[model samples]
Target: MPVARVVVDVMLKPEILDPQGQAVSRALVRLGFDGISDVRQGKRFELEVEGPVDDDALGRIHKIAESFLANTVIEDFTVRVENGDAS
Candidate 1:
């Protein structure tokens, strides 16, 4: 068995306004970064799973993501399983 890495990307729904993202976009323009029309901010979560990340583990992670990690009312999330260390 080996350790596997899982990634969870959480982002606000398109319909929702992202103030932080807007601020970042404004800052970029102030810093002379032009031609970029829009920007959105998101959250990323990494989990280290021992042994193999089987279907059960993935299912549990999905539940965790929906239950604890993301606010379903205004956000969406995706789960991905990756092999070995990311770095």
Candidate 2:
């Protein structure tokens, strides 16, 4: 059976503070990396499923991302479906 590959990116809301990102940005500056103004940390998730994925499956994945992967109150997420490769 063919498989579907899904990728989800979760990031903090604009108003939410990201201390880790800030620290990384500062470190970069200290290391002489210029032109770096701001940074925000995020998470990426890759999922593989057996069989072809449809709209219904996408909806279910979105629900899972919103409920289990991201904190909707302080974070937002985006889901992407890859075309051919499932690995």
Candidate 3:
């Protein structure tokens, strides 16, 4: 079997408050960077998987995101399979 490449990006919901982001924005303003309004922090993951990748595996990955990788209550994630290989 070949390898499957996947990428996962997790981001906080737009409506949610981010204190760290706000702090960065304020610091930028103090540093004379004008018109910089907002900042948000997010996580990205690049993964390579062995064997075939089907819907079932994708579902499992989603569950992993929900259970471990992301805080589902405040964030949402998107998963992309970059390359699919079945050899």
Please tell me which model should have the higher TM-score, number 1 or number 3. 1
For 46-79, candidate 1 gives per-residue lDDT tens digits of 9888877899999999999999999999999999
How many backbone clashes does every candidate have? 0, 0, 0
Candidate 3, residues 16-73: lDDT per residue as tens digits? 8988888888999999999877888889887777887789888888888888888989
Question: Residue 18, candidate 1: how far off, in angstroms?
Answer: 0.1
Question: Cα deviation of 81 in candidate 2 (Å)?
Answer: 0.7
Tell me the whole-model lDDT of each prediction, alpha carbons only.
Answer: 0.93, 0.92, 0.84
- Collision pairs in model 1: none
Better of 1 and 2 by lDDT: 1
In candidate 3, which residue pairs clash? none
**Where does candidate 2 clash, by residue pair?**
none
- TM-score, ranked from best to worst: 1, 2, 3
Model 2, 1-87: lDDT tens digits are 877789999999999999999999999999999998999999999899677688889899999999999999999999999777435
Off by over 4 Å in 1: 85-87
